[model samples]
Target: MRISRLAPEVATSRLIARTSGLLTVMGGLGAIALVLGSAGAMHPGAAALGPVTAGVGLVVMRWGHRIPLSGYRFLMAAGVVDIGVFAYASPTVGAAVAMLSLSAFAAMGSFLFFALPCALGYLAELLVMGAVVVVARGDVDAGVAGVLAVLVVGCAGAMAVVAHRAATAHEDALTGLVNRRGFDEALEAAVRATARTGEPLSAALFDLDHFKAVNDSRGHAAGDEMLRAVAATWTPLLPGTAVLARHGGDEFALLLPGSDGGSALACAEALRAALPHIGTSVGVAELAPGDSPADLMRRADAALYRVKSRGRGRSELDAGGQSPMARDLAAALAAGTSGGLSVHLQPVVTPADGEIVGVEALVRWTHPELGAVPPADFVPVAEREGLIGALGAFVWLAACRDARTLSEATGRSLFLTVNVSGLELDDPGFPDRVLATLAGSGWPAERTVVEVTESLVEAESTRSVHALHVLREHGLRVAIDDFGTGYSALSRLDTLPTDFLKLDNSFVSAITTSTRRARLLRSVMALADALDLILIAEGVETPEQARALASLGCPLAQGYLYGRPRPVAELVASLTAADVVDPPAVALASG
Candidate 1:
């Protein structure tokens, strides 16, 4: 397939810059105030000290834009110092002493931004105030000073929490990178800045390959660890001027200020090569003068899809910022590309006797323009855009229609299990639609099974759960697909009316080597047996894996070892060649 390049928005750099500026101005002001007030120059003179400190605050805030992080720390220090000086400048002797103490407290609170300097400032201010009182012979109220100091500290503490929350809100909690939301805001600012300065900026999107299978096989916690490891690997390799963030899940976005497509591509290449086992697909696009964030993101995603189409572990530069595949798919859809999407089936056999009991229906898209776009390439985009429901229904109808024709021919009942997406649950008319489709096609509902996953279950709403129960009530079989991968595995098993548990390949992978995995697989098999649920092992890619699973008493198995998924016609031929008798056609749902 001819894949198009991605053009992500240049937004993250502007945001990082803005945040650095704010922190610098605030930090510097606190630091300067603490130093001046401690020297006794900014002390009792409200007249001279007030304007001088305010001027210093303004300068620090302004300089922050030029040297963000350094300026932020400097201003923050100044702000803390000025707070203390403002406290000591009170009219009465007792109030001045109290204000000095308040200054010390404020300095202590500023430690959130500048720990060592602020701490030293706090002690120095207290000592200076004590010395002033001793030398001047003025009445000093240590009690009032102590009370005011504590109050200032409390206020500073509250402000610190607010600042921290604001920072965290823009960051991806999982990887400490700027999140998509933060990236968007930054991109806009960068666009404006670039327009004014006439400098180029670039954005890139990276996606991990086979991430879902990894999550399903290893647990979400391990997946999270993998994500963090990837982030850690890439973060330091980025140029100091770059802004990077974990956009969400297995995706990440990088914004580079003053960088062109070539530079961005180089950086992406470096990051692509850093990971150990997993590969990454990077889509990058430099900002064109007036492009919108949405347009850039689309370009980047398209480019990413292009990279993925060619197979991952490569960086693709999108100078034109066009996702040809996505654009082609869109055009095809508009031009009635209904024929482009169709189901392919793979056989699942009883491991005990190598007898075919059923086939799993998978969808394929052969775009008229893009040509044979991989399912992984387009499926996520479909799901994200809510097109999966329509696609799912189409596949269901076709699979059921095929099953109905096959069932009546053989006299032996053949079961067809269709993959159900998370979207189907909330599909208001989903259950009724399935039932109606079955009735229209004269297909038996009992012969069809809807395979859903625990991840999909998490995506379901309460209404979807009700809809699922309704489907179950109508005599349709429901199997929890990819069992043991989701966080809510045990809970879903205990609650949802599931008839089969499809073990993810990760457990099967270890069964051949590790005793622990073998033991765990045994327990899972035992649990399924105890529950009287059918067990199907997924991803039995090798004969060895298939044999090991069968030895563990897993009745059903599916993977490339038996036969890879192919078009319906091809799948049927393979099954016939394997000597499985075709069942007589039996009517089932339309989809």
Candidate 2:
């Protein structure tokens, strides 16, 4: 197998071992040459010691992949043995210099193993180097030898620090698992291996169910402990060939080589069973012909979405076939008409006064036989089956009609935010279609916000940009939804035709639990302020989170704390009631 196919840690160990082995062999050959050239003065025992140690070191290096961590320790011990042989057989300045250089190299290699061992190894090397300098004073100037020894040890220490930093950059600070960058590299390697060998390659994406509840209820510290526990429990259970990485907050991805869907599913199930208390949902997809890394991950994510929708604490495998449920969803989308789809509104309120400032339009689906199908399950199907345009039209018309009614009932202006898919944006007639919808409902274009996700905005397509500018020119507002969750280039905010930035729920969830996250939220708020964009924080589930957002100078927030998504009539009733009460008391009454 290629060294790149090995696990990162094992690969690193193998590289260090091979390098040290080669150096040992070179030192041995040099020692033998010295003995032959010096004739009567140099001892033959020292010459034999080099070649013998070199052979053993090479053998250890050959097996380095199997004994990853231990191989480095053996090499370090071997270096010490080589130094002892040199000091005893050839007690001269040249031998002293050779042993000291070998000791420095060994010290540098120790860092590839671990931190504590590296520190101890460096100290031991320093002591040995000092003794060599003192013992060889008769052959060389003591002052000069001491100064060279200091320089060599210092250079070795610098090399160790550099190596440690490089390794740490690829490691997750939270769980000590491979981070996203490392995961991408490992995934690319797996893809290459599969292409070469025709071996089955599978990937699984897992999300911890209700992990936010743990962070919100117990504390962030407890949540961190839970994540650590998960990593520790699952790492040993995985096959050595499998690569596990922390994809991000509350999510993990696994790369399994030489495994088909069945094996991957079994592994995911075993992981779920092992962590029953911390419920997890997993999605597995085996590599298809001519698939890239992104294609594999997307399919796995779609499968994960299936598990999350059906229920958490389960594993589902994608075998490149349509499931019966997906077929039903596709059928339902095809039959979607006015009655088949409905709009639900969740209020976004001012944190200080708790007055409803806006409402986010969420689409829900219910079928005769399928019961209440969640939007997560069917939205992708709709998008994939070319029904999103029809679905989007329905949502926009319904939301505008309801928003006009709500505003009339409450006797106040209320802006309505509706989600627009990337597919709709790419449509040449999207802007004209939106205007027609608003005109049909007699809702002012100025009061409607078309929310697009960060990913779409990052696409920066000419068509999308032109469509957005057209919508803006018509007095409609554009929002970058789920900000900070994707490839968010904050600098682009200045150039993109956007009016609002909705900070994603992931950051909001951790705001109260992590000081660093809290600071980050403040920084994001500051950026929005500089861009002159209205900021709305999503997923504000607690009064504490609301207060935190307010303290950070965020004016608007939305989540279950204000109200869960409900029918338009219920939202109108709540809005009417809030209008009658003192605005400051509205929050308490709603709670």
- Best candidate, lDDT: 2
User: Which run of 10 residues does model 1 get worst, by summed lDDT?
Assistant: 1-10
Model 1 Cα RMSD, 1 decimal: 14.2
* lDDT by residue for model 2 (132-177), tens: 5456455655675676567667766686667667766778999998
Q: What are the models' TM-scores?
A: 0.47, 0.47
Each model's lDDT comes to 0.66, 0.75
**Model 2 spans > 4 angstroms off:** 1-14, 21-95, 113-160, 192-199, 210-226, 232-242, 257-259, 273-279, 309-313, 321-591
- For candidate 1, write residues 183-302 as lDDT tens digits: 888787777778889998889988887687687789999999998898888888888768888887788899998989898899888888787588788888877655776556655665
In model 1, which regions exceed 4 Å deviation? 1-91, 94-138, 321-591
Rate residue 280 of model 2 by lDDT.
91
